[model samples]
Target: MAPQRVVPLSLRKPTHAVCVVGVEMLVDVHSDVPRGARSFEVAGSSGLEVIVFYDPERAREPTGRFRWPLHAGADVVVSVDRASKDVNDLKVKVSYFGEPESQALGHGVLYLTGVDISLDVDRDRTGQVKRSRGDKKTWHWGPEGYGAILLVNCDRDSLMSRDRDFANSQLGSLADLQDMSPMVLSCHGPDELFDSHKLVLKVPSSDSKRVGVFCARGGNALSDYKQVLGPHNLSYKVERQSGEQEIRFYVEGLTYPDADFSGLVTLSISLVDAGSLPEVSLFTDSVVFRVAPWIMTPNTQPPMDLYVCSVVDINGSNGKFLDDMSYLAMKANCKLIICPRIENRNDRWIQDEMEFGYIEAPHKSFPVVFDSPRNRGLKEFPFKKILGPDFGYVTREILLSGASSLDSFGNLDVSPPVTVGSKEYPLGRILFGSSFPNSGGRRMAKVVRNFLYAQRVQAPVELYSDWLSVGHVDEFLSFVPTSDKKGFRLLLASPRACLKLFQEKREAGYGEAAQFEGLDRVAKRSINEMLADTSLQSDSLYVQKCIDWNREVLKRELGLTEGDIIDVPQLFSLKGPYADAFFPDMVNMVVLGKYLGIPKPYGPIIDGRCCLEEEVRSLLEPLGLHCIFIDDYLFYHELLGEIHCGTNVRRKPFPFKWWHMVP
Candidate 1:
C-alpha cells in the first residue's frame, strides 16, 4: 500500500502563517514557537468546529489562549470539524498573540480544513503491515495476490487437553497463541490528540462467528492478554495509553470455509471524532484474510512417517510383514509406527480407514487425519491416537447414503505435481475411483466428495472403480519419485505387460518352470499350463481394458505421455462379474522417497530368481528407486489386499504455498 500524503504546517509569531489548502491536521511544537507568541487562538466557520488540545483537563475547547511556552507540557493538537470537499467550504484561522506590529502586517491566520485519520494492515499480504494507499478493501489473486491468510485453529495446542483450539472460547495455554495470525495497529501522532478523538476496531457481525481476536498487552500473566473481539463482540476500543503508538493483535479462524462461511473475513479500524455532536467516523481501513484449506500429499513427496497395523486371527498374522516394514523404514530414514492388536482390533487395512493431510498458513501448520466413514475396527483409531498437539482430525459420515466398498480411502489417490495444458497443479490433482455415471451400482459418499472439493486447491477427478470386486484406485495404480523433468512416474498395473514377460520366458525354453515352486496350500501352474488356459487369457484381457480406460483418463487429466508412465507386471482373475489380482499386486507398493516396499510375486523361478521381481527391479531401479519385495501372499494377498491397502504413509507437505495460486 502507498503512504498517505503529508500536509505542511507553518505558523509563527510577528510574521504571516503559511496557508496550505486541503490541510488535514496540524500540531504545534512548543520549542519551535517563540515565547513572543504567548498563546494561540483557533476559530472555524459555519460548517466546521475547531477543537484544540493543550491541557489534560477534560478535552476543553480554546476558550482562553492555550499556553505557548508550555513548561514540560505536551504538544498542542488541532483538529477541524469535517473533511474538506473540493471547495474549502469551512475556513479555519489561528492567530498567535495580536501584537501592534502584527496589526500592521495583518492577522497571521492559519487555515485549517480537516483532520483525517487512517488505519492500515498487511494489505499486501507479505506478513508486514504497511501504510494504506490503494485498494485496501478488495482482495485479488495471482502470484501478485494481495490479502492476508488465516489458519483454522483446528489442531490441539495444549498437551493437557485434546479439544481443538477453536472450540475453546478461552485460550488453553500461552503456546496457543502461536496458532493465530498476527495483525499490527499503528496510530502515531501526538499522544494528547486522542483526547478529542477515539480509535475503534470493528468486525462485521457476520464475521464474528468465523474469527476471534486477542490483544498482546505488555504483561506476563495470561489474564493480561484477553480476547478483545470475537463472538458477540463486534467492536473494540483501542486503548493507547499515554505515549503508546503501536498495538499488536492475534486473529484465529473459528471454522473452515464451507456452505455457510465464504472463507473471506474482513476486519476494519475506524477513527471517530468524539468532540462532534453525534461523533462521526473520519476514516476506516479494511483488510481481508482467507482461511487456509486442507491439502493432501501425493506419493512424490518424501515420506516422513510410516503407519501399519499388526493383527492375529485364524487367517494369519502379520509378524513377518511388520518386521519387513521396520527394516524398510530404517532404510528409508523414516519413523515407523505400529498399531498393536489391542489398538487395531484385528483391522489391518489402515489405508482404508483414513487418509493423512494437513492445513497450512504463513505463521503455523499441522498434519490432519481425514477419517473415512467406513467405520471399521480402526474407525476410532485416528481420533483417539493421532488427534494430539499440532495434529488435527476431521471426518464426514455417510448418513443418508450408506457406505460401500468404494467408500474406503484406498480408492482415494493424488497424482504427483502435473501441468495440464497451460495450467499447472503444483500440489498435484486428486483422483478417486467410483462407478460409471448413471450406473447406479456404487460410488464414494457424496458428503466426502463435497468436503474434498471445498478444499479447492486440488481439483478431483472420478474414475471407474466398480469393475473390480474390491475396487480401489491403489490396486491398479500408484506413483514414485524419479529425477526427471516430470519429477515422478505413474506406476500402472498391466496384465498385458505381465503376459509378455511370461511369453518371452516360455519361448526361452522355460515352459516347465512352475509358479509358487515351493509355496504350499496355494495351487501352482506351469508356464505352458498358464499359456494354454484360454479362459484365463480372456479374463486378463477384460481386466486390461478396464485398466486402459483409467490409463487414458490419467494421461489426459495429469498431462502425461507414455514416457512418463511405467507399467508394473501384474494380472487379475475374473471372480463372478468382477476381478481380483491373479497374484499379489506388485503395482500397489509403499513408496518412501527412493525406497519402494513392493509385494513379492511368487512367479516362476528361472536361474534361481523370480522373473516377476527381476522384471520390476529392471523397470524401477534404473530410475534411482530400491524395490524391496516382501512375502505378503500368505496374509495380505490371501485376504484380497496388498501392501498399499494394509499400510499408510504421511508425506511432507508441498513447499509451494497454496495462496499463490489464482484458484
Candidate 2:
C-alpha cells in the first residue's frame, strides 16, 4: 500500500498530532541541515517504527537507532503499531552531528496516538446489520455487481405528516424512520486522543440537497433524532462522548435521481488537525449509496388485486361490465376492488387515471402509485384512498401548461424481462407513446416524461401513437404470459390479418355470414359486402401501414423476432385522419398471470361458435393461457375503450433484486 500522508518534521521543537494504525507517513530528511554536518541520527520509542532508506537496493528499518552519513537524497518513513493511551507516550528524535557535540541539533517530541477509522456499507444486496466492511463506492449490475442501496423517503408512515416524509427536514414522527437506510461509523482509539484533535462528518455542497441524515443517539425518545444533516447543514462536528467506540446514522434520499444528478450520494468523515490555522484533514473515509428507482411491474407478474369503476353514464351502464369482471376475478382467484359511482363521478376509465410502481432498499420495500395529471373523476382517488401506511403517492403535473390526452397512463406499458443481445433488462423496459416526428401534434407532458426518464433502471422507449382518436398505446398492442419459448408474447392489432381472415372465410363459402349479427343499432355486414366496399378497403390498408411502422420499432427495440409476436385479427374505421376500433377491440385485454379477460368480439356464429372468438382462442390456448371473453361492448367498446381501459391490475414485483443490475 502507499503512504497515508507526508509530513516535514521540524527540527526546532517537538511536533504533536494524532496518528492512525498501519498508516505510513513519509518524513522529509536531510533538508536545511548545517553545511558541515557529517552525519544524521534518527530514533523512536517502542510504539513507533522508523525506516531509513537512501540506497535503492537496500532499505533498512532501524529497530533501535539509525546513524547515516550525510546524503543528498535519503528519506525517512515512520509508522505506529499501538495507540498512545497517555499524552507524549510515543516520541521520535532526530539529531544533527557536526565537528563537536555542542553543535548538535536538538530533538523534537511527537506525542500522538494511532486511531483506526472505518466507514462501511453493504456491498452485497443484503442488510449490513452485522457490520460488513465491504467496498462502498463502485456500483455495477449482475451476480457480482456490488454497491449499497438506498430508498427515497417518499412514503408517509405517520398520519400526522401532511406530506411525504422526504418533503420535510424536521422529524415529524417515529414511524417515518422505517423508510431510511442505516450507515455505521466505527472509530477505535484511546480515550485521550480526542483531547486535542477533532473529527468531522460532512457532505459536499453539491450533494447536500440530495440526501438527509439523522443521528442515531441511542434512545427511545423521538427527540433523540432531532439532529438532521441535509440541505440546510452540510457538516456536523462529531460529538464523541468519553469511551465512545462507534456511532451510527440513518440516511435517507431527499429526491429522485435526475439527468443533472446521477443518483449516487456520498457521505464522508474526515479527521482534522484542530491546531492548524485553517483546519486541514489528515484522513478521510467515505461511503457511496445509490437511491432506488421506481419500478413498474409488467403484466407477466402474478396479479395481486384488480381495480375498476362503476358508473351509469348518459350513454351506457357498467353494471354488466362489473359482473363479467367479477366472474373473471373469481376464476383467476384474484381480489376485485370496485370504486363506486359516488367516488368516480361517472368516469369509468380507471386505467387512464394512474399507474402502479414501487421503490425498494436493502432493508425495506413498498408500493407507490403514480397519479396522472389528467384531473378526471378518479383524480383524487390515488392520493386520498390508496395512499396509506406503507403505500406511497407520487404525481407530476404540467403546472404552466395544460395536460393533453397523451398524458393519460393508458399510453404507458412495460415489456417483460428481456435479454437483448448482451444487455439484460431484468426489470424490463418502459414503453410509452408520443408524437416524436410530428411536433405539431399533442404529446405527453414534459414534466411527466422527465420523471420517468430519471428512473435509470428501466430505460424508456417512445412510440408514435398520435394517429389514433384516443392516442393510447393500449389500443393496438398488449403482452400476455405463456409457458412457451419466450415465456410471453406480444399481441398486436393487425387490420391486414383481419382482412385475410375474412377472405379465407369468403372463399370457404361462408360469405353470407355477417359481422355484429345480433347487436342493435350497429351496422352488420357480410364478408362479401365488407370486402367489396372500396372506401373501407382503403382505410383498412392505411391503418395497416401505420401499425406496421410501430411493429418494426417494437421488434427492433425489444429484440423480438416474428415468432415472438402474435397478430390479433382487428379492423378499424377512419374518422377523418384518426382511426378507432370498428367492432370490439380484442387487443386491449386484462392480463393476470396465465389467465386473460378479453373483450367479446361479436362476429358471425359459424358452427355454433363465434369465428373471432375461436380465432383468439386458437392463438393463445396452445401456450397454456386461459382466455375468458367478457361482454364489454355496450359500455366500453362503443365508448372508444375496452376491457383494459375499464380495468386495472396491481401485480407482484419482480423476484430479482434491482441492486444486482448495473444500469
Candidate 3:
C-alpha cells in the first residue's frame, strides 16, 4: 500500500456564543499562520471586523484572561467591527506587516447571527458542559414555551469521520465540504408529550431570507399530531440538490396555541450534515417538560348500558324486574336494554312495555340490542352477550351462534361473562363446568376467542371448574374497577373466609357476636345440607377443588394475589333438590360503575334484624366501593337467579387505540 495522506485541520476560538446586531466584539483564532505574520483581515457577509492584537494580554481585557485563554493555540483576537451587520458566516485571513502575502486558514468559519439560542440541560440543576462522548443532557418543554436551542460550532472535517486510507484507494475527492450547507436539526421525545412531529426550528428574517419556523418528527411523541396542530397544519417540500434528497418543513401557516398541547415531553436535538457522503449527525442532551391538558384515565367511569331480562322475576314480585332495573338505570344515568325471553314468547311484548334498557352507544348510529340467547333459549339467558362488545352488527351473530344442544342444567349454569385486563384492553372470559361437557362448551369458547381476536382485544381466555347448582362464575366471583395500578381487583365469595372473619370477631368479643353466630349457623346448615344429599356429595368435593383451581388461576392469569381478592360471605343450600338448589351468594352482584348492586340476604334474622348487608358493606367500603341492595331473594335466589342473573351490565366500551396497547 502507498503512504497514507494526512488530512488538514481547522480550529476556531469562542466555539459558541450569542451576540446582538451592531455590537463590536473581539474573537480569537489559532490557525496555520505564515512565519512573521503581522496583520489579518476578516471576510464573510457577517460584516465582522478583524483587528489582530500583537499583545494577546490586551485582547483578553473584555473577557477575563482566565476565561479567554491567550496561548499558542489561540494567539490573536479578531474584533467584530462596530458597524458590522447581523449575519451568520465569518472568516479570517492573516497577512505579514512587511509582506503583501496573505493566506486563509484551512476551511475555518465563525458563525455570527442574530438568533438567540440557550440550552438548559437537566432542568437547570446543573450547567456543566458535557465534554466526553455519550454525555447526555435533558430539558422539559410545554405548550406555553418551546424547548431550549443550542448554538453549535465545529469544523466541517470534525463533523464527519471517514477512513482516509480506504477513501484515497477509492479515488474520490475528500475535500468537498460546501455540500453540507443548510444543516438539518431534529428532535426526539416521549409519545406522551407532544406530537411525533415535534422538532421545531424558528428561523429569523434578514434582507436575504425571511423568518420561518419548521418542525419534524420525534420518538415516543404523542398521537393526534393534526389535532395538536389545531387549525394550523404542516406543509413540506422536497428538493433535489447534488444528486441528493432534502426534505424541508414550512411552518409559516402553523400556530402554537396554548390549547393545542399537553402532557410530559422529553426531547433531544440532532444536527444532520447532509453534505457528507453518508451524512454526519450530532445529538444534544435530552430535555423533559410538562405540558397542559394532561389527559388521564378516570379512576371509575360510569357504566354506559345495562342488560336485564324479564323472564325471571327477582325478589318474588313477578313483572317487576324491568321496573326495578329502570330505577337502577335512572340512578346510574345509563340506558337499560332488555333481553326478552324466548321461552315466554308472550313476554316479547314486555320488551316494548319496559321503559329501560334502550340507548345508542356514543359512536353507534342505531340502538344496541341484547338478542335472545341461542339454542338453550331463555334459560341460558341473553346476558351471555357480555362475552364482548358487538364491534358491528355482524358481531351479534357470532355471539349468538354457539353450540346448540346445551342441557337444562348446563344451560342455566353457564358462567357469567367476566371481563379481565386493563380498562384500555379488556378481555371477556367465561368459566364452564367440566361436568357439562357439550358441543356448546367447545363452540362458545371458540366463538368468544375468535371474537376477541377479531376485535383486537388484548385479554386472554381462561376456564375454571364449576360444580354448584348455579355453576356460574358470577355466583362466586366478580370484578370491580378501581383507581389502583392494577385497574381492578377480584371479588371472591369464600364461605371459609367469611367463617374465619366471623370466628375472629366472636373470639374478640365484638358486639355483633349474636349476628355472627346466626350467620355461622346458617353457613354450617347449608354445608350440612350439601353433605347430606348423597347425589351432591361428589359435587361438594368438586366445589372445593373448583374454588382452589379458580384462586390459583386468577393469581396466575390476572396477576393477582390473595390481597387483591375481596371475600364476601356466602353459603350454598341444596335444600329444595338439585334444580331448587341455590346459593345465597353475595358475590353474585351487579356492577354499575362505582355502585355495586348486591342481593340483601333474607336468611334467619338475628337480633330482630339481618346484618349481612352491614357486613358486606364493611368489607367493600375500604376499597372505595358503594353497595346497593337489590332485595333479590324470593324471585331470584329461591328461583335459582341471583342479582347477576336477574340483571347484567353493559359497560361503556373502552376508548382503545393501536398505540395505547404499548407499555
Candidate 4:
C-alpha cells in the first residue's frame, strides 16, 4: 500500500490553526504522530500564541495546534506535514479553560481593611494584666501566654481604647499552658451599635500556620442578622499541600454553615493559635468543623507490653482499699488488680488459702483481700476450690512453702492480735497507724498489722495514714509521740498542716526541738526547709523528700550514678497506702549497700531482685551457681549444679570463699 500523501501549505488552504473564537472549535490532523510536537505550523500568519489541548487522557502529547486572536465566528485550520509524526490521524478542540477574567480568582479584589470590637469583662494575660495595650501598634504573646479582644486599627497603628479594653476584659486570664483567649468579634454596649470599622483577625493553628481574614463591622463580626456577602470578599486561596489539614470557623452568614473552629483566633498574628484554634472555636458559633487529613499525627506501631499489675479480691467495708497495693509493690512496673471478696464465714481457712494462692502467682502482691465470715462452711468454700491445677493451686503451694520456715513466726506470736471468730489471736502491738485520708480510718491499723503478720513479719508493724480528706487530720496528729517504734507510723499527710504546725512552734521560741523529737535527722531537715520557705509549705514536702530519697536509693540499687534522675513523682506513680511507707528507708538503702558493695564471690542475690526459678537458668548461663558439696570436711565445688539436681533435691547457694573460680 502507498503511504498517505502530505498536504502542501498554500494560500487556498484554510490558514489559521485551531482558534477558540467562541465556546469551542475543532482541528483535524492527518496520518502520522510525532515524538516531539513542539510547535504547530498554521497556514495563516497569526501573531498571538494560543494554548493547545490534546486527548485529555494523554495531556503531554498534543495531536494538533490552534491559533490565537480568536473572534466569535472564527474557525481554526491546521496544515499537517507528512514528515511530522505527532500530528498524524487526530482531531482536537479549543475553548476557554475557566470563568471570565473580569471575576479573577474570587468574586472581586480585596483591599487592606481593619475592624474594631469591644469586651465586657476584665482580661488578664500573665504580666500584662493591669496594663492595656489597645493603642499599642503590635502585641506579643508574653512568656506565660496572652489574652485580648478581636479588633485592630492598622491605619492609625494603635488599638481603639474602649474596644481594646473591652476585648481585654473578655479575655479574662491567660493560662500558663495553652492559650484560649476568646476574642470579642462584636458586642452590644447597653444602647448603641458601634459597627463603624473593619477588624483584622489572625486565625492561627497550633502547627504555626497563619491565616489573616478581614472582618468588617456591621458585617459578619457585628451583624445580628444573616446578610449576603458582596463580591469583594477576601480571595486568599491556600493550595492544599500534600498532607496539609484545615479547620474552618464560620461566622453565620459570613462563613459557610459547616466550618471547623479547632484553632485559636487571636488579634496578635503570632499567638492566634496558641490555645484553641479559631477553627475549633467556630463550632461554638453555630457551625460544624471538618478537619482535613493534613492535621493528623502519623501512625506508629503499638506497644508490645504495657506491664500492668492488679491486686486480687479485696474483701472488706474499707479494708479492701489496699486493692492496688501491688501497684506500689511493683513500683511503676504495672497497674493494680481489683479482686472479688470471698465471704464464707465457716470457710475462713479457704480465704487464707486464697490469699496464699495469689501470693504465689507470678505477679506481685497487693494488700487488698475479701472479707470473710466466721467458721461455718469450710470444705464447701469457693476460695479453696479456686486452687485450679493451672494456676491457683501452684500459687497456694508456693506461698505455703515460702511461709514454712524452720523458725517462722506464726499467728501465735502476734500481738494486739488477729480476731478469728471471737478468739483474739494476739500477734503484735500496733506500732503506728497511717490514717486513710479518704474514709474514716476504719481498721486501717488492724488490717495492715494482720497483712504484715501474714507476709511473715512477726511483730511491731508500722502503719500509714491518709490524712487529707474531709476529716481525721487532728486525730492522726495526736498519735505522733507514743508510736515511734521501728517502722512505726510515718505521717504521710499533705505538707501544708505539717509546715503550719512547725512554723507556729518555731515562732513561739522552741525550734526543731519543740515537737516530734523522735523524727529522724532527714525528716527534721525537710521540716526546716518547709518552715524557712513559706512558698514550699503547701507543696508536699514528704512526697518530695520521698522522691529525692527514691532517686538516691535507685541510683545505689541499680548502680546508676550518671543518669540517676529516673523515678519522679514517686508517690503519685506508686499504688497503695504504704507508697510512702518505704520512704523512711529509701535514703538508708544507699548507705547500707555502699558498705556491702559487690560482695566477695558476688555473694548470694545476683542483681537486686531475688532470683525466681524461671530466671535462674538464664542467669546461670553467665555465672554458674556456686554450690559446695562438703562431705566430712572434704569440700568440692560444683558449677551449674542446680541444673543437674534431682526432682526432690533442693538448690542452695554456696558460702563466700576466696577459692571460688570465675565462669
Tell me, by TM-score, which candidate is best. Answer: 2
Residues 196-255 of candidate 4 have per-residue lDDT tens digits of 211223322331121223222222323322211112322222221222122121121111
Candidate 3: where is the Cα deviation over 4 Å?
1-301, 311-320, 337-373, 376-391, 395-445, 453-456, 501-542, 573-582
RMSD of each: 10.0, 2.8, 18.1, 29.2
Scored against the true structure, residue 97 in model 3 reaches a CA lDDT of 29
What's the C-alpha lDDT at position 131 in model 3?
A: 20
In each prediction, how many residue pairs overlap at the backbone (N, C-alpha, C within less than 3 A)?
0, 3, 19, 71
Ranking by lDDT: 2, 1, 3, 4
Per-residue CA lDDT of candidate 1, range 1-663, in tens?
111222323444322121121233444434344345544444556655344444556333333445232333434333443444423344555455535234222123434334344455566666666765566677666688777778888778777775777777667778878778888876655454577778898989999989998888877676767787888789999987876767888889887776566789999987776887898775677778888888999988889999999999776677989999999999999999999888889999999999999888766788988899999899879988888778887888988766898989999998887889998888889989998778877788888888777787888889898898989999999999999777999999998998899999999999888887778888899989888899889999999999999999999999999999899988889989899998899988999999999998989999999999999999999999899999888778988899999999998999988878866
What lDDT would each prediction earn against the true structure? 0.78, 0.82, 0.38, 0.22
Pick out the ten consecutive residues of candidate 3 with the lowest summed lDDT.
Answer: 250-259
Model 1 TM-score on a 0 to 1 scale:
0.80
Query: Candidate 4, which ten residues in sequence have the lowest lDDT sum?
Result: 292-301
| Worst window of 10 by summed lDDT in candidate 2 | 56-65
Residue 243, candidate 2: how far off, in angstroms? 1.6
Return the clash pairs for model 2, or none. Answer: 14-109, 141-661, 141-662
lDDT of residue 181 for candidate 2: 82
Rank ordering of all candidates by TM-score, starting from the highest: 2, 1, 3, 4
Candidate with more favorable, higher TM-score: 3 or 4: 3
